[model samples]
Target: MRAEVHAYVADAARLNRQPVLVLDPLTALDCSEAGYAEWFTEVTEGIEAHRALVVLKDKECEAESPRTTMMTVGVRNLRAAAPGAMVFLDATQLARKQDPPGVARTLATWSVKETAGVAINVGEHTPQAVADRYGIELRQTLAVTTGRRDLYVVADSSRGGVASADGCNPSDARIGSYEVLSDNPETTQHLWLTTPGISDGPCGSAPASKPGQFVPELATGLLAGTP
Candidate 1:
């Protein structure tokens, strides 16, 4: 797969040989260098000449000329090589397929405030872990998160706050022919589920004085979660 990706990148010109390969997002990527030729040809010309049912209007060529039937006459516009300092190649087999010092440079360029700035560590890693891995020092800084049980207390509670979704989105989707969508375990988890074409996933469990008011327990801290 790496060989195919390398070949395809060289041929199609995806990043223009940028150093960072960014392998995390390629979890299920399914492109092959072998398929590039067929795809490029189809995209450029072959498919249209074979499948076109009606004549297209063109200013450059007479309708009788075969070039008119080709997808792009004179190859006036379309080019396979991407136009950028970076390269981007895409092919399918239906299938196919960064970091460091760059960080120092970015931090230096931005003059990032060491004490005030906090890092967002995505996935299973803690922000502290990310900073440590990347050599970014955030002395005495902390990040609040929702998915984990970790917590730290300072003299001031206002410094950090929870970042979590306020509530679940009630599903509106249904199967074909009006079959109601059954969220099952997830549907049962919510405070209330709305009938289709009725409440439109009304928030806050649908039982309060105001129609859209935040529940009394959550009202105070929800805005902090956002800000």
Candidate 2:
């Protein structure tokens, strides 16, 4: 049923020249726990506040729990089938541990580089952290879709349900304010901020996203989700 519905949508989008959004996948379905673990090797650690989307609760040792590369591949397939459709893939924010650790505890990055024509995600705090940590912008990261890598920093200082921190569900300002996530001087605002965002191409140094552009990173996702 899911496949049929997705196919129907893809066909409709292609025929009508409409845009289609796809959420990342969220299931390892056929694979066992161990198999899933192999695919998901990195996750957030030591941080008191975190999001289940980044590191699954109780399943951190394993992958995000119930995930497979096929999920990402499906997005590619959808894009191929719907050439005319504007496919956007929104994935969760993920980071890996660095041996030396830098400005932040965890690296601000995203996974699944290829698939959607554009990628949009509510990165709790990652949107700002990515800029502060790497000294780069979010749109340039691997987080955005492989095609037009554009990231939008529309809001900040909010809690979960829509997009919130994991551990304590801190606001975007708090989570991305410093390295350890306790508190830092980098934060300028404690309230939500909005931006118009770009849609033409990836923002930052490179206009087009290459395979090895940003730190590679996905988990079970919506493939097509609602805001």
Candidate 3:
């Protein structure tokens, strides 16, 4: 399983090495004007092909601040130049506790215009739900949980399912089918009976297999557990 995860991450890295543009709206206010100018030049110079531009698009900024104007101009320019680049405009900075409604709206708009993904950073943020409201692709992050001994599939909350959809997504998913796609074969327990889409099987009462010990039939059955 460890080997499999490493290989998967490696493949994903290789596939996404294309030139990218990152628009940051979070750091343009604090630093000195000269410091920002120099810092932007220094950072952008190193990654000319991988562009990173900072904008001061905070909703709270004065309408007259040069940084505010620059942010608007920069976003307009970026929209024209790299229309398809991955774009992220932080809205948290603009709202109460960084939960600005306008920021969420901005994220949804940019996500659609750029046809890209957005990350709503922490801070009681429910921005992803707002993204869903806009019909934007909103996939929640899934993390691997490891016991003192080893890594395993604890839960996947992306779907808001009863137990959350974990184990794997089905291959060749139909346009709107509710089938469990592919079972991730690497989780430590890999218990099929407890999974969301498979039927109960003999493994229902089977003890979780330890690290380095695999029982394919029991695992397969466990993963087949249905919602």
Candidate 4:
């Protein structure tokens, strides 16, 4: 699995695209120190080679848990190994389930000061509310459709303006695409583009039309203060 992940990262980098990698420490809680160190070395080497961003999730810092100690060691190793690669800490689960709202705010604040940014899963919260509470700017809005169900992806700008929208389509709708609505910092306004898919299959897709046809129009409209 780690090799496959590294291959994907290398491929994405070769294409000049940014790839997001999510790492969950809970999955390897029982691995030996030496084994985990090997994994970390591989991950750091991949990051250095691909310039990929990694999000470390589900890291526990509880006082009495052995996992907490491992988590601390893992983070230190990652920072030491890949000091230049972008890495973000995600403690949304801890914030939502175990800690108070203040905990999330503190985490967000610290992340902004320490790493690239933080990842927050606002499961049942409004984007505006989360942005206000965390004092972060709302960066992008993504609409994901799968069959008859729809999901929205919202995140703060402090985490960088990057996100992924994916879902399985088992219904007649059969359409799978992603629309990104983002704020153009230079214009102080929002701009959006929709990249439609040609098929529902994961790899069976291409841009619905030539980018030259719509890209210019969208840019012109947004620059002229037209959404």
Error of 4 at 52 (Å): 1.3
Clashes per model (N, Cα, C within 3 A): 10, 18, 16, 0
lDDT of 3 by residue, 1-227 (tens): 22432343345456773332233433454344443444344333443333322222333433334444444443444454434333334332333343333444544333323322222321111223332332121221111111111111111112222221221222211111122213331321101112222222222233343322444543343334344
Model 1 / residue 153 / CA error / Å: 18
lDDT scores of the candidates, listed in order: 0.23, 0.28, 0.31, 0.41
TM-score of 3: 0.31
Instruction: Give me the overall lDDT of model 1.
Output: 0.23
Relative to the true structure, candidate 4 reaches a TM of 0.48
Best by TM-score: 4
* lDDT score at residue 68, model 1, on the 0-100 scale: 20
> Model 3, which residues run further than 4 Å from truth?
1-15, 18-30, 51-85, 95-124, 134-227
lDDT of 4 by residue, 1-227 (tens): 55777787788878987666766655553455555566677677766545755666655533344543444445666677776555655545544554334444444333323344444541112233343333232111111111111111223222112222322111111111122333332111111112222222332122343422333322232123213
Question: What lDDT does candidate 4 reach at residue 223?
Answer: 28
TM-score of each: 0.15, 0.31, 0.31, 0.48
Best by lDDT: 4
lDDT tens string, model 2, 5-61? 345445654576322122223343434444433322211111112211121211122
Error of 1 at 31 (Å): 35
Q: In model 4, which runs have C-alpha deviations exceeding 4 angstroms?
A: 29-38, 59-70, 97-101, 104-113, 122-227
